[model samples]
Every structure is written in C-alpha cells, then in structure tokens.
Target chain A: MTGIEPLAVAAAGLMGIGLYGFCLCRHAVRRLLSINLFGNGVFLALILIARRLPDGPDPVPHAMVLTGIVIAVSATAFGLALVRRQARTRGDDET
Target chain B: MTALDSLLALLLLLLAARCVSARSLLQAIVAFIVLGLLLALSWVRLEAPDLALAEAAIGAGLLGVLLLGTWRSLPLGHGNERIPLPWQGLRPALITTGCTVLAVLLTVALHQHPEQAAMSGLAALDQLDAAGVDQPVTAVLLNFRAYDTLLEMGVLLMALIGTLMLDSPLPRDTELPARTMLPATLAQLFLPLILLIGLYLVWAGAYSPGGAFQGGAVLAGAGVLLILTGFGEGDGRDGWVLRALLAGGALVFTLAGLLLIPVTGAFMAYPQGLVTPIMVLIEFSLALSIALSLLLLYTGTPGLRRRGER
Candidate 1:
C-alpha cells in the first residue's frame, strides 16, 4: 500500500467505528462524541487527498478544510445546546 | 515512506479507534483530543500548516474543553448501557465486507487516475505573490475565494443564534459556584501567557499558519476557564454590546465588502494597495466573534458578564 492509501483506509476504518459507536451508544453525549469521531474521519480523508496534490499542496482544499473545521465546531456547539435542552426538559418531566 | 509519516498515521488510527471505543466518556474525550492532535500532525505531513494550527487549536483544544464541560453537566451513569447489535451475527460480517469493497474501489480509482490539475488553484498560485500574502492558504481563503469565507462567517453566526434560541434563559448568577474545584493556581499563572500567544497567532496569520479561527478558539478557552473557576458568569443577557460583538465580524466583513462594490466594482474587492489591511481587519473581527460565540455556546447562555453583576 502507498503512503496516502493507508491513511485513507485508516480514516475509512475510523468512520466505520464511529458509525458503530453511534448505533450502539444511547447517551446523547456519547452519541455526540461518536459523531465528532465521524467528522475527524472525514477530515482525515480530506487531508489525505490534500497530500496527494501535485507540485505545491493544493491551497483550495486546505482553505476548504479550514472552513470545514470552523463549521464542524459550530455544529457541535449547536448539538451540545440541543442535548442540554433535552436533558433539562427530561429532568423537569421526571421530577 | 518516511518513518515519521508512518508512525503518525498509525498513532492517528489507534487514537481514532480508541476515541469511539473507550467505555468511559472521559476516556473517549481524551482520546478524541489526542486524535485531533495526531490529525494536526498528519496535516503537517501533508504540507498544510494552516490546517495543522486550526486542527490543534479549534479541533483539539477548544472542542476538548467543550466536550469535557458537557460531560461534567450530565448526570453520571446515565449512558452506560451498550445496545446489542441488532442482527447479532450477520451484521458485522456484512459491514466489513461492504467496507472492504468500498475501500478497494477507492484505492483503485485513486491509483489509476490521479486528480485533474486544479486550474484555478494553479492560477491562484501564480498570482499569490501579487496578493501580498506569504501564505497561500490565507490568500486563497481571503483573497481568491473570499465569498466562501464571508458565507462561512454567516453560518457560524447562524449556528450561534440557533444555539441561543434553543437554550433556556441564563440562571440568575449563572456563574459556576466555587464548589470543590481543582487547584487553578497554574491556570491563573498561565492565563496571560496563553492570551499573549493567542494574540500573536492572530497577528502572525497573515504570514504564517496561525489565524483567526485558532486564535479565537484559544481565547474562548480562556473565557471557559474563567467561567469554570467562578471568576465570571453568564450574566450578560441584557448587554447589547456583547451581542453586537458576537455578530460584529460578519456584519463588518459584509459591510466592508459591500462598501467596496462602488469603488472596486466588486464585492469584497479591496481598493488597490489595501488588501492586506482589509484582510487583517476582517480576521480580527472574525477572531472576536468566533471566541465570543464559542464561549457563549459553552456557557449555554445568551451572553456573559462580570461576576456579581446584575
């Protein structure tokens, strides 16, 4: 296997593991972690592709991935808010 | 074929697996942070230092704190049960087979026909020197395709707004109480140093890998630490100024870009000889907005204020 290919495979494996974790984890927090794992896996794939660009490294993909990181964190923050709200409402209901 | 690349890739894979597989949420969060660090290393290997800095700061550091804070607030032993696989025996095999086939196809395709040359990127590379920025990624992000960056700033603002809408009003005295907390002496000693580094990163972004996003995340970490240690609280709900700062980056960037339409005949087009200054302006605003947004997200409140305030 070539250098980039292995990284790609490993990233794909990470994606699979994240998917499995998401499927089996019931806790919303754990599920969030799993979803983040999935995101990192996609990021890994993008970096792998970035490595393969001929001549100078592809700046476009690098820029896109940087944007992607910001978007991912924003989304994760939003997801955390949703989780907290659900937990709070559930607790209120239980009490 | 370098040993460093192989070792880093191996470490990344192991950490990625552990992040998902760890039984303890704390362990998983730690592993996830490590995974992000290793991923940063991978980006460095790929010759993407801009991404490396971003992955380390935002991906590993700020996100790690957010995850840990959320874990702290959740009730203990709430998510301990692991669900059994639905198909019992056949599912694992099927998944493995499907994955293997997909991997093979991808590998074959990548090996057979490499990606076509990015024509615009090549053009950008040719004109990079004229853009007055030493870093290609920054030039691309702000100069070559600034519309995307502008839109991304909008997405970030929208996300923060969405989160605020979903969260309940901040508790009176929403600052965390000083209950059995870790010794924060070290944090106090290091806070100024970290803030200095964050500012340096933002300033250096024009020429190097460090930029607004990473610096903003570091700044947010500082705010998070202050909140955790009972030094401050999420009490800025009535502070319209705080909300404006949170929205300032996008608004300023958009307005500045629009203002250029008449003079430059294009949105976001800087007047000749002023591109770098314009970029710096946009970046600083972005850093403030991003930091405030992330801090507010963690606080789970509309805003924050000084401790003991109304």
Candidate 2:
C-alpha cells in the first residue's frame, strides 16, 4: 500500500472543495470560480499522470492541458459577460 | 521535498476553501488569484514549465483582472447576500460523502497505471529530429495533432464573437479620483520589455518551454497593463483591421493545412526542408491573433484606441 502522492491528494481535495462551493454558493461569479477550481484540479491530475510515463513526461497531455487552459479562460470570460448582461437586464426591468 | 509538497498541498486546500466561503466578494476574488499563482508554482514543481507559464499569465493574471472588473460592475451587495442552501441539513452531509468517495476512487485509479499500447510521448521523442521542433510539446501541438490545434484556434475565435455579442462592456470609471503619474510611468517602462519577452517566448517554443498560447497571454498582459494605466481604452467601432487580426490565426492555419496538401500529399504536412520556416510563420501568426483576441476579451469591446486618440 504505497502512499498516494501529496499533489494528487491536493488535486482531489481541490475537486471536492470546488464541488462543495459550486453546489452551495448562490452567486454566479462564485459558482464560476468553483467551476474553474474544479477545472484546475482536473488539469493538475492530468499533469500528474503525464509525469508517470516510463521514458519521460508525456507531451501529448501537456499539449492538451495547454489547449484546455486557453479554452477554459475563454469560456469563463464568456460566462462573465453573460453574468454582466443578466444583471443589466434585471436592473432595466426593475426600473 | 516531500514535506514541502505536503505543506503546499495543505496551503492550496486552505486557500481554495477561503476563496469559496469568504464573506466579502473582494476577499474571495483575492483568494482565488493567490490560489492560481500557487497552482502555477505546483506546475513548475511537477516539471511542466510550459503549463506554469500559461497558468500564471492566462489563469491567474488575465482571469484575475477580468474577474475583478466584473465584480466592480455588478450591483452593490450582489454576491454578499447569503442565500440559504437547499436541503441545508442533509445536502451538505451527502455532498461531502459523495466528494470524498470520488476522490478516493480517483486516487486508486491513478495507482492502477494501465499499460498503453502506443506510447505517444516516446514516439514523439523518437521523431524529435524530424518534427521540426526540439520541444516535444510543440511537436505534438503543431505537427502530430495539428488539426486539433487548428480547431482550438477556431474555438477561441468563436468564444470572442460570443462575448462580443453579449454587448456588455464592463462599466469603467471615466474620471480617476486620484489620478497619478506613477502607473503610466511604470507602464511606459515595462511595455517594451513585456513585448520583447512575449515575442521571444513564441520564437523560443521550438526548442524551449514557451509557445503561442503562453506568449500571447503575456502580450495580452501588456495590453491589460496599458488599459489599467489609462493609456488604452476600448473603442466602439470595429475596424476591418481589427477583425482581420482577430480572425487571422485560424484563417492562416486552415489555409496552410489546405494548401500544403498538394505539395506534401497530406494535409498539414510541411515539406521536409521547409518545416522549420513554415512552423515559425504559423506560430507567429497564431501568437498575433491570440494576443489580440485575449486583449479584446479583457477590454470587453470590439476595438481598441490609445488614450487621447481622436
């Protein structure tokens, strides 16, 4: 029974905390932050797996994570834009 | 080293908990930003310098600015109100149990370490000399899986378009209550160096731990700094040139892959002697488009103008 890697434990902890936040937090921005945290956890896990290959660190997963990071940022930006638009519309309707 | 890793792990979890549960929105945002920086550090420790660079620039730096800006624009006390959780008593206990079980499963699966049939990393290493890039990650991205990279550019472009369609520019404070010369002076000092480093990162990707994505994010950081200091602002008009810069990366990538089919008899396959130059051209164009796209997203506008420009 080998001990689990510390970083791997951290990665799992992040996912759990993110899940808890995403479920409990009511604010859109907070939920988004939780989602991003969840994403960071997944990326960390993939990176750790990449380190486990026999020869050296795997380049394929590295490339994939890079692509994933850019996509995640873009997606989050778009979501933030939606949040802003929703708030504005709600304000307009109230007035 | 193990002890240090354990400490970092503990710190990361603690910060993440704080980010989600902090009473003030500002405190939560600050905690998230610090968490991102720490994640970058962990990436470095794990031997992924390229990921570290990208995570710091894009994940922490750019995203932090965007989040803070959005927070500013939201109605006062928007996120501060504590809405009672659904099924408050049973839900939290259930959620905790579920998440804990999931984590244990993931850890156990990772330990299993199944054998892979075709080890892509080893294969990429074997063909490094012919891949036209000394960096294996670069080789994988621009050569072996070039199609995926091209599609990613399309995804980025579409995301920008969607954000534009939202038509919600972050509300800006037009008048600075205490306008100072320090920020502008600092921006002036650092802009050239930032630009140089960004371009160098793109060039260095062929043989080192830098590439279009990381380089573009750094360049976008430069744009962010300018805007923060009032040297740059979003303009209402969308010029033809701005459109071109935004779309050029995918256009060039698609055209390169299509046109080379006749010469190499396979899509995206660069001829042997011309691989390096072709990759360099593609990389720089990608970097340019990416940098501009990210900058536009940050500004939440269609076009950009320097301060005091008519």
Highest TM-score: which candidate? 2
lDDT of 2 by residue, B190-278 (tens): 99999999999999999999998889999999998888888878877799988997888888889988998999998898999999998
Model 1 clashing residue pairs (backbone) = none
Docking class of 1: medium
Model 1 stretches astray by more than 4 angstroms? A1-4, A53-55, B83-88, B107-116, B168-183
True contacts kept of each: 0.53, 0.69
How displaced is residue B192 in candidate 2, in Å? 0.6
User: Tens digits of per-residue lDDT for model 1 on B1-310?
Assistant: 4567667767876786677566777888899898888888877777777788888888887778777766666667555554444355676556556655765565454444445766766777888887657777778877788788888888888888888888643233344346335535656777898888878778887788777877887788888777666667775364778878988888888888888899999777788788888888888888898889888877777878766677
Q: lDDT tens string, model 2, A1-95?
A: 26768888888888887888888888999999989988888888888888876776888889989999999999999889989989999999999
lDDT of 2 at B213: 87
In model 2, the runs with Cα more than 4 Å from the true position are: B81-88, B116-118, B177-179
Best by lDDT: 2
Chain A TM-score relative to the true structure, per candidate:
0.84, 0.92
Q: TM-score of each candidate?
A: 0.89, 0.96
The lDDT per prediction is 0.75, 0.87
